[model samples]
Target: MCEDEKSLLEKAKNGDVFAYESLIEGYQKKVFNLALRMVGNREDASELAQEVFIRVYKSLKGFKEQSQFSTWIYKITTNVCLDELRKRKNRNITSLDEEIKLEDSEIKRQIEDDKPTPEMIVEKNELKKVVSDAIKLLSDEHRTVIVMRDIQGFSYEEIARIINCPEGTVKSRLNRARLALKEILKGKAELLSYEFVK
Candidate 1:
């Protein structure tokens, strides 16, 4: 945390709502993205992101400053997502019938050439679905590590802190997660063939 962030934290802890909002502004997207990848839906991700902020607000007073504030928030976010996943698992609910929306910011482009044609857009959507489905198939541990390291771009040390594990464990889990995702995607080669074979 820099001096500015420290100042913001001080104000927020003293009951400045604007300061609190400002402090979290930079992390909201990352938190939501992490939740989105973990839960596999926009609606659930939105709700989970809100819940993470609420938990942050409630626990802010107890923050010891022993670690980076971002790390602490990420830890909370991961826990909330994993808990929700566990609930869904216990309920035996897996819903893939709904079409996954392709928000402009959420859609990642490969080449970034000219404006996408309709066919390109359709192919992108299909590819996104294939990847999302494969991620959803991962176990909670594998999925969490992959999201933190790969999707969220956290370093291995940072991920170890966020997930409260050894760096070696994070690396091991990430390797296994990558292999698992590859296996799942291989089974869906048809989905990627048209989109990627160019």
Candidate 2:
């Protein structure tokens, strides 16, 4: 965290609502993106993001400076996501795999290529959907690892801290998750046309 954020955190801890909001302003998109990927739906992601901030606000007073404030917030985010996943599992309502669908804008946001031919754009969209769907098919552990490391671009150490695991465990899980995703993507010829799989 930057000095400004650190200062805001301190003020927030002291019950400054504006300070609290300011502290979270920079992280809202990241939190929501993580939630959206974790739960596979916009509505649920919105709800999760709101809940995360609420939890952060309530827990701000207890935050020790041991880890980056971002890490602490992510820990809370992952816990809430996992808890919600468990609830969904217990209810046996639906599989998470079937619930997640990435919007075109979200997919496009992840890719930075300039304008392409219409045909190429369509192909890219298909590829993105295939990739997103394959990620959803992964187990929660694998999905979480992929989302944090690959999509969110967190380092191994940060991921380990967020998930409360050793760095070795983080690496191993990420390797397994990558393999699982590769296996799924191999079945998709559209993705194969791109250089990412190779």
Candidate 3:
């Protein structure tokens, strides 16, 4: 976290609403992208983003100053995403695998704003969706490890703090997560229409 964010977090922890908004404003996209990646749905990600902020609001009072604000928020977001996943697992797993259908007209609708060819834009969106789906297949521990290390770019020590695990466990899980994702991607290359660079 930056010095400005650290200062804002201090105020937010003391029940300052404006400071809380400032804190959320600083990390909103990260929290949303993390949630979106975890759940693989725009609608679900939006709902999870709102819930994540509410969780942060409620938990601010109990937060210790030991961890970075990003680490702390990530811990909360990962846990909430995992919780949502568990709840969905008991209900229906297929919800996570549902395909996104963007109409051809939707692509043409963007022609005025987008300078890139329609095919390139569609490919970009598809790749993002593939990543999201690949993430959903990981075990909770592996999933959070990848999300923090690969997606969010946290140091292993930071991930250990966020996950409340030893550094060794963080490293082991991250390695396994990478391998699993690699295998899944290998199997999914046909669907993605291009193999990811090794």
Q: What is the alpha-carbon lDDT for the whole of candidate 1?
A: 0.79
Clash pairs of candidate 1? none
**Segments of candidate 3 deviating more than 4 angstroms:** 1-15, 95-124, 190-198
Better of 1 and 2 by TM-score: 1
Candidate 1 residue-wise lDDT at 33: 96
Supply candidate 3's per-residue lDDT for 125: 74
lDDT of each: 0.79, 0.79, 0.73
lDDT of 3: 0.73
Greater TM-score among 1 and 3 belongs to: 1
132 Cα displacement, candidate 2 (Å): 1.0
lDDT of 3 by residue, 74-125 (tens): 8888888889988987898644443332321010011122233325535767
Higher-ranked by lDDT: 1 or 3: 1
What's each prediction's clash count?
0, 0, 0
**Order by TM-score, highest first:** 1, 2, 3
Indicate the worst ten consecutive residues by lDDT in candidate 2. Answer: 103-112
Q: Cα deviation of 89 in candidate 3 (Å)?
A: 0.8
How does residue 122 of candidate 3 score in lDDT? 51
Query: In candidate 3, residue 10 scores what lDDT?
Result: 85
Would you estimate the TM-scores of all the predictions? 0.81, 0.80, 0.73
lDDT of 1 by residue, 1-198 (tens): 988988998898888989999999999999999999999999999999999998998888899887899999999999999999879866767532222223211111122235334355457676677577668766677789878888889999999999898999888878877776665565555544454457
